[model samples]
Target: MSERFLTHQVENQPPSLLPYDAFSTDLPLREALAREGGGWAQAQVQAYGVLAGGEMMALGVQANENRPTFKPVDHYGHRIDEVEFHPAYHRLMELGTQHGVSGFAWRHADSEGAHVARAALMYLHYQADQGTSCPLTMTYACVPALQQAPELARDWLPRIVSTDYDGSHRLAWLKAGNTIGMGMTEKQGGSDVRSNTTRATPIGDGLYELVGHKWFFSAPMCDAFLVLAQAEAGLTCFLLPRFAPDGSLNAVRIQRLKNKLGDWSNASSEVEFQGAVAWRVGDEGRGVATILQMVALTRQDCLIGSAALMRQALVQAWHHVRHRRAFGRTLSEQPLMRNVIADLALESEAATALTFRVARAIDAGAFDEGEAALARVITALGKYWVCKRATPFVNEAQECLGGIGYVEDSPLPRLLRQAPLNSIWEGSGNIQCLDVLRALQREPACRAAYFRELLAARGGHVLLDAEILRLETLLGGDPTQLEGQSRLLAERMTLALQAALLIRHGDAAIADSFCQSRLGHQHGLAFGTLPAAAPTAHLLERAWPA
Candidate 1:
């Protein structure tokens, strides 16, 4: 008898389907964009989708896998204090800025669907890579703050909005296009930016000399940064450059790079400013006002980013489970697996619906105060709820893949690690919840605008109506009592808004199931506890067509 007997090893797996058009295949995204604004700048969105699905996806993987390295000194023993990255990282940066992912809305502000279309493109790009988005997002948001000082903006707006990705570390004016970073949080003061101790002494005119350390200096290689520091007029906003106007390197020293839980492809540093060259952006005591517009824009991107992460996780799970089989049946045929997938799909759709709607509101708000007020509340609301849901949603999706999902090689691990970042990036859950309360308490007109939204879907569904009634009391409650209930209020408000959108535009199956499980409380706390009324098969099929 032969001692070596061969056992059959099966390779039943889903082949890599990268380079597919993420835009065309994503059903909910297409519908949401069309409904929000019909004449979207579609060519760019489609092109980004192509890159996101194909070569860009691969580049994202390679970049993150080979994390950037810090170089304190170059070959000549000079103190360059640089962060070296793989060529793949540079390629991803070029791809993003080249396609106007960072500056599309600013450059095309007149386009009716500019905000919505940019949101769509950003949604696609987030699925490809999370790390590269840091600098890109900051660059886009910095536009609004820069507008606070038009004279200062005149010198840099053209460079900021340029679609080219000039990765050179030269002066901002010397580059074809420039990237911007931010430094608000110091070691002692985190989200408490009001307590920032970075000192800024006036150097004549609006210029200042900054001497302080930023706990988190994001995208260390960027040509410029929008920073917060203490000035003679209290906390103020300043623009700190990497190189002086005369082309010599500024006094920005990279103390060290953070070994983060995720976002490996990007470099975040602890930076020290020893009399760095700076220019004040706005009035001395009005730094907070200038920061608000930029932060609001960034927070909206956080909502969109979470939605994209959820979608990416679902796609990975759907592909793996549909192909792999055990117990003489494909995993998709399993009842419990089917329920989980359907539930995940529903949450993702709900998030997508709200994200695009708010983007439409933000675009509309340019000329309407009521719309602007509405955007303020909804943006904070969506940011909190969507970011909170992302981690759990991605975790369940990863579980659907079993042991293979836990491995480093699988994309799930990366998605899993990246999931919590958005929740913390612009602001944590508490910050977002409190901000919603701030909207309701300080801005009655904003509350009224939100109420108008709630009333639009009145009598359309009993669950929605009941939830709206509850939200009314919360919104009108005393400010002191409301702070303790911020989380609960935010969850209810966000769900109510999502339910309204689903009922108006989503399929009957998704809408009915969401109301039953979320509002009616027909099931337990965990997912997959869907009530019998759920159109499970239809939901799964719609979420991932054959």
Candidate 2:
């Protein structure tokens, strides 16, 4: 018994590091907020810090850690398309909503950097739990579309801003706070929402009856959904409520919940609307344009989401290596492991900088057309680049822990699964890259804005200077030639912007290393490939103070 009990004793392992003061420990984030004039958002940061660093995160994550179950019929066998969540999911939703993770920025619409502050909040909360952020993201995204219709906006804005998280599937009119879902992709046309087969026939007074199937209807139990369906004019935007104005259930049929590879906390379903009552959001045929208002907001969240994942993964790695020993020495003491940790830290910092920068632009974009255009482009490129980097970054971080990291019980596995969701959501990597090219080609103002951002750091660093030249060359070449190579160009543009930001705001050594390894190609392939001279210990401490 003694020998067996001794065998059960654990060896070196990482301590459970709760995410503490995500806003404070993240120096890059702090600096970015200061630049955006949101340095005063310390209160919000502290609030999130307490929640993320405590049992809230553990309970919230564990609640939905088990995938949601699709409930097609109620106890009495009446047809009811609903999704059941763990109590943890509801609490997280309540907490997130209470804190304006969805509406705080919009509510304080006059603030100098409301959007930046919101971005920061999202980044912190997502690090705590990834799946529950889905509805919060959709709720935030849906506001602009609602505003397109004064009548609708006047009616819904109050509810949208409500911090109360009402999960019941009832008339939104009766709820204190109502969450919204979205359905843009259909089976036949995924991203090409314009090709949707769902049809909307005008009933009366700008309202219509929609009949079509949505390939992916996320957060099915939401109070309402912003959906796209073909009307006589073309693909049009519509708001389909779970209950009619008279409190009758709408004819939305939930087919089945998707068996997704990850993002288990939230429910995503295949749904159909049979003459479902819906009111037009914008004008008929303005579906894509209107939905894009939502898409752009969600895209920024994707950037933040990816950064959160990266940050959490980095923290876990740093925490593990600090305690775990190998070869008679702590892993953090190992030279190669140090390099890998530093590289990951660099990536996380770059992502954070880009996310907040774009958020600042979005806030300014409200009044400045040029800045708004720039935000449009920055978000897409940032989303594509940061999200694409997240999977690999977290993967390497996971590998740092070896076998335990691969197990489902560890946070690393959940993070690894959550990493790709951002890259693939809103738009896929290819779609984002192509969209960036589209923005450049179609919106000259955006292109000019993009150039201005790059030129701000022109001559500060040799690597940035060359990367800027390469970006210009890509733009100057034939459109047809570059269109197929847009991903290549998007990658260059993303790196160039990150390099510039680092040069302007990051530490001299970190910026120098970032440019040298990322821009100058002075490093070898993979995570541990930072040059031997790189200050690995300093990087680790910067990532999370000792």
Candidate 3:
């Protein structure tokens, strides 16, 4: 009966990808974790991988399909300034918190590779749902900023690190756990927080009342936000909570939830602070410096988030090609298609390798000043390059699936929409490049750390050696003249870093393809345009073993 009614049967369509082991099957991720000293967290990573690839993914669809809604007032006309989310969104947050996406690094601060392990956790959770990652990332990032004020840290650290997820809108002190948000940019200044007009008036006991607007108030539902405003001295950092000390709702007004390009499951708002009581976190006029600690960690997640998108999109495309057939063979068996998949695989693995290496650097930085400098410079350049590549990379993976990939039913479109957000959110490409330049020009230790890394991988590949030399030559130029070419400089440094990681720690096939296609510029401008010597079959198998 069904056959008679059907116009045509679905034949070549591949089944949806789910219930797979996101961690176990990822050879590069597993290898990176082991190499980066996160081996102690293997079992935990594996468990979260299963959840991320399975039920959490299903919940991600629900959360995004039913986006968060702005509930500015209660039924009785009380201004609530709240954002209402789908149940699935809360569930995703719960799973993420339980798995330490919000607090792993701090919780295991003394452990080796704690940040690396935490980075891996966020990487997996991001694949499940990109939107929910906003709050998760901020909660983890807020720790260092809070520590600037011992009183604030003492009051907030426990809740921030709590494994439990409390979505209650009550006072943070009353909750078992809490999430933190950030509001830095104003309508007048995007990244230039020093231009922020938000004003903070002094009150007793080191508290102040903030009155101003934030054009991009991220994750407004969080219990509190770390915001910037002008104090008597100058621009200052403050912790503004939703509820004031006296149990009254702070006058933080949510103007409207941003109708963003993607990240529908999360709520970003335009907010006006009307005498919102806040506590100063650091020295007055050092707001930029104080919040930058949080920004650095968030930028790391931006890299991880972008890399996760590449990997997830690659997995979707790779799964489709293996199952869907055309021209008398599976798409994966076609030579051109194989080249594209392998090229994507190379990009994905290279991104993963570089990100994890940076995470390791972060872990090491906890004890070593040299490593700290390396982490700072690398995070800037890595964030710049990896995030810039995400949109194009996802679109290329989409091309591998042709029209089906463009359709909403496939994950590629969502991935593509989410891709550019990372590049734009924490700081745009130009910002990252400028940061890299600043590091090189002003921070001698940073420059030394960067070069030390490159020299360690010297002679790994001739192309790599040449690329390193070029980077050195570029750096040798007058610092004043490099501003216009900073983007190119950042891109070159990032490619060199990725190539070095792949050559030294990644799979040989993947490394060879990356060095040839990316470093040597031996391939076309698009994915799948690998050189003749590229091992397409081996690369595909290494990406996601048959």
Candidate 4:
């Protein structure tokens, strides 16, 4: 790609209004897409653009008389951006009942709403640039419907999975594939799959009927669904197709689309099923495990998608700091401004490094029990931290922009509203922290092994010494003696473990060095200790001794 394409200034306008011709020679994106099997980058960009356009539409950009048709009203009456058009929203919705209620339910009520809105806007920009339809959209929508009704899975799965459809006027907007949209939410349950009240009973001839009301049917209008129902065996997953084999409405009915905080372009519906035709997705009682497959994928995607947005926000902030001036100098020249930038850069890089490390682990086929559990915990941490940091970083960037940052025209304002959703999406920070603790407590040996491996990867002696010293200072040299005062100590230890894992597994050596060096600097400031010989020793050990 040309230098211009690689660092092109994105306009604040809705993507549909942009000229696609300018992106024709964008080699970098093309190369990236090619690396991911020729069409991946294009699809990612397209999905991003559609997501962005959807957000713009919700923001009244293309509305008649410049007034939005659907105001931001969530199920709880909070004002938010339209969130339905977001791919993440659909992604989660499609998983339906297969996912655990605790994490998935919280995601729907909190973060998924914003993700959908932002993803819609991002996809809009991508589609405009790529001049192509997003394949993931419809597929994302259909999976949920398929999951709810297995009979529809056979028919709809082929239509949406993998992009071979030849139909004209194709549902370009509906780009996802056929996978069960697991509908695990229940009206009486409190975001816990174990607490589901809906029931499914076996009637003969390979057919099971379902009766339940799902409160958050994210993409209820999709082709199929995976609905969760309680049976004598335990909580079970059932596939519910939206239409019969002849393409008519099945027993499912839309109760209503939710009013939400953000991403309102698409629908987050509440639905009712009266004996909906469905089939089981795996074993009858193993719904949690089966659905977790989809949930894990979605959670990882949430990290990537949110990180992508954070990258965008960071770039936007960088541009502002470099160009926007105040008090006779550029904002980037100010000491306080530089500090803010530095802080955000460190946070962004750490989050990105952790995300990629987890992705690579998944790619390497390292999903053993220990690895899978750790990945989930790390994913949750990454999501929470990235999402948590992004909003403030954007806000700080906006602060640099002063009044302009607060305006609708400024990207920072939108980013500020959009970024917070990430921390809440997939799972809340508290929930993730608890999961990390649970993993550490429940599988102490696994956790210790994982930590030991991380230490070895970072040069065991050095990491161990560094961590011990850091902890000693925090715990005042004795953990047992500081039991009541160990919360902060525990938190630091967790962060240290997280940082070590990322450093040992990340792709870029220079980046890792920079991170470690930065951490060393912080440690020196906090503990008043300098590693006089460690850096040289570490470098020498990794290099050939001459």
Q: Which candidate number maximizes lDDT? A: 3
Which ten-residue region of model 2 has the weakest summed lDDT? 4-13
Q: Local distance difference test, per candidate?
A: 0.88, 0.87, 0.91, 0.47
Task: Name the lDDT value of residue 450 in candidate 3.
Answer: 90
Q: Which stretches of model 3 miss by more than 4 angstroms?
A: 2-6
**Per-residue lDDT of candidate 4, residues 251-352 (tens digit):** 666655666554333355677777776666666777776666565545555555555555545555555666666788876677666555544554544555
RMSD of each: 1.7, 1.4, 1.1, 11.4
Error of 2 at 383 (Å): 1.1
Consecutive 10-residue window with the lowest summed lDDT within model 4: 126-135
- Candidate 1 versus truth, CA RMSD in Å, comes to 1.7
The residue pairs found clashing in candidate 1 are 19-53, 19-54
Runs in model 2 lying further than 4 Å from the true structure: 1-5
Q: What TM-score would every model get versus the actual structure?
A: 0.97, 0.97, 0.98, 0.64
Question: Per-residue lDDT tens digits of candidate 2, residues 62-107?
Answer: 8656678888888899987777888888888998999889888888
Q: Where in model 4 is the C-alpha error above 4 Å? A: 1-160, 164-180, 366-373, 444-449, 457-465, 468-494, 501-546
Choose the strongest candidate by TM-score.
Answer: 3
Model 4 residue 209 lDDT?
78
Q: Lowest-lDDT window of 10 residues in candidate 1? A: 1-10
